[model samples]
Target chain A: MIFDTQRAIAWINRIAELVRADVERLTTLDTAIGDGDHGANLDRGMTAAVDALAEKEPETPGKVLITAGRGLVSKTGGASGPLYGSGFRAAGKAMRDEGDVVALSDALEAMLRAIEELGGAHHEDKTMVDAFAPAVAAFQQAAGATADMHTAAVAAAEAAEAGLAATVPLQARKGRASYLGPRSVGHEDPGAASTVLIFRALADVTAE
Target chain B: MSSSANGGPTPPSVGIVLISHSAALARAAAEMAAALAGPEVTIRPAGGTDDGSMGTSIDLIGTAVREADSGGGVLVLMDMGSSVLTAKTLLEDLDDDDAPAVRLADAPFLEGAVAAAVLASTGADLQTVAESAEQAWSMRKL
Candidate 1:
């Protein structure tokens, strides 16, 4: 599937809707190991991003993602704002017109790089990187094998879900959850859960 | 006071940006720090989300860093988590030359802010302000 500007905007809008619907669930997950504000903060940012995209009417897929990212950076409070904002912005920069599976995979890789560089979190850190890194790898693998955006996105989302689940039983080594030490075990990382939601949104939009 | 190029008293040589999740907490800390640092130091509070809810704002911190800096460098003191991440992201976005030297101090928020402010007010440089804030970590409470 060719991911165009319209598709990017649709994906963002869908993400906003999904995040709003799952705010309580996400916040509950965060309350177990984080500051319990991830859902509300991300919801607020996504809402603003949708509004910004509607107002800006960006002409290109890259512009759409960049605008949405800017909105998130300005509207969302906390570390998630900058981390997610930079990720989206980096992906946008790497994306191309009528982007194919390779392009999509490259974009996800760029997003993961930006997040990793900014957060300094690695795999098994029980942070968003846990999900994001694996999702990027899954996208690359699926794209290399099938050269299909839908297949790549679905694979990425599935990998992200597994990564998110894996966060449980691992002690957090970054962010507020790290302060809890062993107490953080058994609680899924809020950032990782949110990363899963983002990949799921990507998969859903591409499947449509 | 040292003379500026314009022949007026030189502004303080360093500034402070206090970042926190709670707007009230940041503001109160800035106020307390100001009491010790006097009126000359530039100490800006960038706290809470844009809508005044709990959480740190990157836009707010970016603006605070720009405003607090008066050619002198800015030292950022963060509470935890997102605050530090947000500040680091903001720094990365800025151009190296266009942006003033900004340092993130690893210290307790309240103590660091107060200590940094006092140092800045004395016309200390950016490194000195940041080092003073870090020195707060060694302060023993007993």
Candidate 2:
């Protein structure tokens, strides 16, 4: 349950793989309400992040994610680059500060804070916060109960999935989808879906 | 890049960066701003993602903000959506000690860029330029 440099690297690699596999679906979802480049953009960013991680070989778990975040910021071609990149960077910094299950919750909290602060997201905005906020809350509850990292991560991942599903019935209030107004309802939000992928990646790595 | 620091002709007192989702749109806006404001003003057109897509790239905007900063400051005007979000991130990351101060103008992109550029070319300070740019919010198309 301890996040090491290896585990952090594994998490990122897993995310990249998942994004590549889900690109078509992500793109389709985005095309419904967004600019239609979410999947390809994230795929390209995550691929470059993996390459950057390999080249950097950061010494600590925190540095690994931080370096990957910097790669995301530099390489990604959309808002998610900076939004998710900044979130990861903040989470990595929190991880560096604390190394226990509590740190995992704190890191997720930091990621949520970064995303909300940067994106100005409120709950039910049908943005990444939809998934990220619930994920953090679930992880925090587990971590507060002194649950193991795997358990907390699993809870977080499941919450993220539920949040993603919840987005389907909501109208977009921010980002490109907001322009669609009421038409944005009934479609899964691309950002929230990607956020689910992030939590799933974390849970998978932690479980392993 | 302080115009007053030297005995030479004054440079623009402030710099401007125009951020848009379209590269051509940013370039054209900057071009028109320059045509009206003259060449002395530091204006950078940071448009499109790094991969030549219709989105904002934080890296591109960061570069433009840094490159455009004279000793005065940089005023950033962005189009909607990612451009605004991305610029706000860079704004948060910026430190006044390390770089010039930055102001994000919430105004119409083209109008704000032109207005800010014109004011900057006149040796106005950062606050004045930002205000000029934001004034475009009330600009009437009719």
At residue B98, candidate 2 shows an lDDT of 83
Indicate the residue-level lDDT of A196 in model 1. Answer: 88
Model 2: clashing residue pairs? none
Evaluate model 1: give its TM-score: 0.93
Model 1 shows how many backbone clashes?
0
Error of 2 at B61 (Å): 2.2
| lDDT, candidate 1, at B7 | 95
Clashing pairs in 1: none
RMSD (Cα, Å) of candidate 1? 2.3
Judged by DockQ cut-offs, the docking class of candidate 2 is: medium
- Give me the candidate number with maximum TM-score: 2
- Output DockQ, candidate 2: 0.66
Q: Candidate 1, residues A51-163: lDDT per residue as tens digits?
A: 99988799988888888988888788867888999899998999987677777778778889999998898889999999999999998998899888888889999999999
**Interface DockQ of each model:** 0.77, 0.66
lDDT string for model 2 (A72-155, tens) is 876777888888888888988888534678876787799899989988889999988999999999999988786688888889
**lDDT, residue B4, model 1:** 65
* Candidate 2 iRMSD, 1 decimal: 1.5
> Runs in model 1 with CA error above 4 Å?
B1-12, B96-100
